[model samples]
Each structure stands twice: as structure tokens, then as C-alpha cells.
Target: MNSTTQATLIKVPAVTLGFWIIKILATTLGETGGDAVSMSMALGYLISSALFMLLFVAMVLWQIRATDFQPLRYWATILASTTVGTTLADFATRSLGIGYGGGSLLLLTLLGLTLFCWQRLLGTIDITSVSNTKAQLFYWLTIMFSQTLGTALGDWTADSTDLGYLFAAGVFSGLLLFIVLLAYFSHISRTALFWAAFVLTRPLGAVVGDFLDKPLAQGGLELSRYSASAALLTSMLLLIILLPQRAALKTH
Candidate 1:
């Protein structure tokens, strides 16, 4: 592909083991980093949500303007989604008094609607087809919804359902593993499985972050949120440096 043609290709990284690893790291950081601002610093969910939203918007715009898939830019956008998702979910559930159940249901509904609209408009919601501006917009919207839904779902499993953090993390992680199996062994739709796996990873990260930071009295390690966030960010950066991230090759 020539320069212009290559430039028109999807500006997103292909899905791979490395992709998922970074995703989990980003989500985990989103959880702890968001809590650091909102809980530790007492910014409250609304203010923290507002702050993260600004970051998300800025990162997304930067990604949109790029000519090709840059690992740093793409992953930064993903991280922004997780951070914003954390606070937005918390605000919906805790501050808004929707509870985890209500917030999750609402987020799920919104996610379903976004996917439905994207599929209806493009006739497919596969990441492989996310090359154009509108499709990219839809793609990011789906991601934001999934991230927010993940937080609420994770909190619901851990707190509302009384499953506790470890169990909740286990549940999400098991679901992700099942999705991976289906992707490899089953004839299920790859696109559907991809989305399912994407959504499940967030909850796993959410619970893990909570387990790290919550008090011992609440069955947590009570680690410092800033410390956990920094550790996760470092790990993600190192992995990004070690891994090769490239956009999907245009085969069609």
C-alpha cells in the first residue's frame, strides 16, 4: 500500500494476546487511578468523571488525527476510556443512587443500543471494518460503553451480590477464558466473541483494582491507589515497548 492508501486504513491495533494484556493493564490503572482522584483526593465521582472525560476527549482526538496506528496513541486512548469509565460508572451507581444493578442495566442498554446502531448503519460491527471516520467513532463509542458497563458489573458482583472482590474477579476472568476458548474452538461469530471478551476484561480489572485498594476490614489489601496506578502504568509501558503492535493488514 502506498502512503495515502496506508493512511486510509484503520488506525487501530489488531487484536492479539499483547492487545488483551495491555487492555487489562489499562483497565486496572483506570480503576486505581480513578479512585485515587475521586476517593483518595476526595474529588467525588462527578468531578473525577469530568476530569477523565476531558482526558478521554483529548486522547481520542489525537488518535483520530493520526495517519496510522501508533501504539502509544492507541493505548493512551484506551487508558482514557477506562479512567473515564471508572468514574462515570461510579457516579451513575453511587452518586446518582442508581445502585450497581441499575447502573449496570442502564449501561448495558446503552451499549446494546450503540452496537445495534453501528451494525445497522455499517451492516457489520467487526473491528476489521473499522477504517472510516464514522466506523471509528462507533468503535470508540462502543468501547466507552463497554468500559463503563464493566465497572458497574464488577462492582455489582463484588458488592451488591456479596460475591466479594476475588470471587467477582474470578467470575469475570472465567468468562473471558470461556470466550477465548469459543473463539478458538467454536463456530461462534468472531465479532461477537471479540466484543464479549472485550467487555469481560474490564470487570476483571475492576475487581482486581478494588481488591488492591479496598480496606482490610472489607477484605482488601488496602494498597495505595497511587502506588497501584503507577505500578500498572509502568507495567503497561514496558509491555508496550516489548510488544509489536501493528494495524490489521488490508487483505481485501
Candidate 2:
């Protein structure tokens, strides 16, 4: 296909600083919003997970059927996936009595398997190649797993260790910074780096969200989850509107 046609086929946004900024905010919003429903409202993790899972499925379907890139639609789907990830992780770790470490291990294994299958089927797990329906399926599925894994990792680092929320956030932030350095200064695979950074951002957002909303006795600020979620949502929307993202060009 010609460049024009290839460009038209691309539906996901380009990987830019703006994209990462908005993504972190979306994940933070997901944590607070999910907690608001499941914990604050006393809906329980299982019920909340079911509700968010349905919403996530609907958003993915909408995204898959779209003919062109739509920023709002794309971010909405991301937000849905993150919210579901939060509740699902909570249910697995707390309700199932698996502990945060066990939950993180399980989700990490699932994410790795998804990526392995996606690579074996498509020959590449690069986001730039996600222009067709098959690739989109793998893309969203990988994201779902990654988001869930991230939530688990965040909780593990914060609660299961001496790191607490702020320290856990710092650790993830440092790791992400290391990835950025590798992207600029090393010869490592760009695709690998992208995925690594993408996965790490979720935990960073998770810890930050917990720090914002969890009780002060637990090393948090005890802010209202609803208010925190609203603030994060507003920030994401503002960034999306002000810094319009373009579709990632197909490389394959």
C-alpha cells in the first residue's frame, strides 16, 4: 500500500510525551475511580470488576469497529481497561487471598503469555503495526493484561514492602527514567523499551493514586477518591484537547 493508505489505516496515536502524560493520568484516574466504586461505595471488588469489565468490552468493541482514529474514543477505551484492571487485581489479591505478590506474579505471567502469542502470530508486538483488526485484538488484550499486572505490582511494592505508596511511586518513576535513558543512549530494541515503559507507567500511576486517596494512617493523604478521580479525569481531558495526538504510522 502507498503511504497515504497506510497512514489512513493507523488508528492508535503516536507515542509522544503528551501520550505518556495523558496515559499516566488516565491510570491514576482508574485507580481512584475503581476504588470509589468498589471500596467507597461498598460494592465489593467482584461486582465492581464485573461492571468495569463490561464497560471495557464495550469500549474495545467500539474501538475495533471505528474507521479512523478518534482521540476521545481511544482514551475512553484506555480508561475503561485501567478501571477494570484495578478492580480485577484487587479481587484476585485480596478476595482470593493470593496476596499482592502472588497476584503480581500471576498477572505478569499472563501478560508475558499474551505478548508471546501476539508475537508468534503477528511476527511483531510493535504498536506501530496495530492497524488491522487482528493486531488491534492483540494490542488491547496485551494492554488489559499489562494494566492488571501493573496494579498488582503497585500494590505489592507499596503494601507488601517497606516502600509504602510514595516510595513505591519513586521506584517505578526511577525505573521509567532508566527506560527513557536506554531509549536515548542505548542500542536496545525500541519496541521492547516501549512495552517496558508502558507497563511501568501503570504502577507509577497506581501508587500515586493510592497516595492521594488512601487513609493517612496508611501513609496516604486520605483525599476523597471521587474528587481525586474527577481531578485526574479533568487533567486527561484537558491534555487530550490541548495537545492533539496523531495516529501512529504503520511500519509493517
Candidate 3:
């Protein structure tokens, strides 16, 4: 590759309003898409997780190979993470008999460890530092853990707490908004808030997606998983095309 290609722009997207909009939508799509595979197709969580993990690996490889940011590729990688996250969380929480509480705690611990390791190695967990190979590896690892945690947390809130889907969605949405308030008015670290908001977005999407796809008896809209996933996918694509996505400013 040429020197210009070698010294490419940041691979991660900039932190913009459009980025969050697409992120939340992509995550919701993840929930619906994952359910289509694991539940609707009766593939079981194990098989569905394996399938989505393959796609995640492929997308991550493609992402690591590309010298510059590509919006579609980045979003594809995000989608892969969330889809795999859904089934993986299900396998751990349900299939392995861990229950949602155990699953959430375990995943949260793993996420904390991942971040601690990233901090040890990189000295900072700022998303903008995700420019080189090593940083990207840490970035994706943290994302996977956060995604899994979100799934378990969302399920725990909805099922174990008996708050139902809408209320669960509201709960997470409120938490995210509170984080936003901190980001705006408080002296808290933006990096911390970024990760906080990032992790919370998944659960918000999780409950909303469940609300759409679950049966009427279950307090959901009773929509078809395939149809719901397709609509969410289409919305993301439209937003990607319609909005602006710039590469994060390089700090390395």
C-alpha cells in the first residue's frame, strides 16, 4: 500500500448526533435480526451464535484490513457485533442455566476486565485513539462485552423485573438521557460517558425490538421478526445515506 493509504484517517466514526441515531437503530435491528435466526428459524441460541460469530469475524477482518473509514463497512461490523451479542447472551443466560442476573453480572465483569486491560495497554480508553491495530483490537473486544451485557440487562429488566418491554425501554432510555445530562452539565469524563452511553444504547434497542416482535400476549406489537428486522435495516441504510459520518480525528 502507498504511504497515503498507510497513514489513513481514523477507522472509527466521529461522535456526532447522526452517529447515535444510526447506532440505536442498528442495535434495534440486531435484536430483531438475531431473534429471526435464533427463535423464528428455531436454530437455537448456540447455532445462531456460531453463525453470527462467523459473520462478526468476517466483518472485523474486513474492518481491520481497510486503510480508511467506510460507513457501510463500519455499520456492518456494528450489526454483526449486536446480532452475535443477542444469541450469545441468550445462550449464556438461558441455555446454560445462568439466569439473567448471573449472566448480566458475569458479562459486566468481563467488560470491566476488558476495559481495565485496555487501559493498562493503551493508557486511555478514548474512542478516538482507535486508530492502530492494537487499539482496534481492544475497541472491538470492549464492544462485544458491552453488547452481551446489554442483552442480558435488557432481558433481566423485562422478564425478571416484570416491568415488561415498554417500561424496560423507558428505564434504559431514562438512564441514557441521564448520562447525556452528565455529559452536558457535569465535569465527568467524556470518554467514560461515551462508553456509558454506548453500552446503554444496546439495552434500549433490545427492549424496543422485543416490544415490536414479541407476541401480543407478551405485551408486544406482535410484528413478524423478519419484517421488523427488514424495516430497521432499511431505516439504518437510509440514515447512513442521508446523514453525515466522518472519521474520528486521529490522535496518534
Q: Which candidate should be chosen as best, given lDDT against the real structure?
A: 2
How much is the lDDT of residue 54 in candidate 3? 96
lDDT of each: 0.91, 0.93, 0.92
lDDT per residue as tens, model 2, 32-139: 999999999999999999999999999999999988888999999999999999999999999999999999999999999999999999899988889889999999
lDDT per residue (tens digit) for residues 32-143 in model 1 = 9999999999999999999999999888888877777888888999999999999999999999998999999999999999999999999899887878888888999999
TM-score, every prediction: 0.96, 0.98, 0.96
What's model 1's overall lDDT?
Answer: 0.91
Ranking by lDDT: 2, 3, 1
lDDT: worst 10-residue window of model 1: 1-10
**Between 1 and 2, whose lDDT is larger?**
2
Off by over 4 Å in 2: none
In candidate 2, which residue pairs get closer than 3 Å at backbone N, Cα or C atoms, i.e. clash? none
Alpha-carbon error at 124 in model 1, in Å?
1.4
lDDT of 3 by residue, 186-231 (tens): 9999999999999999999999999999999999999999999999
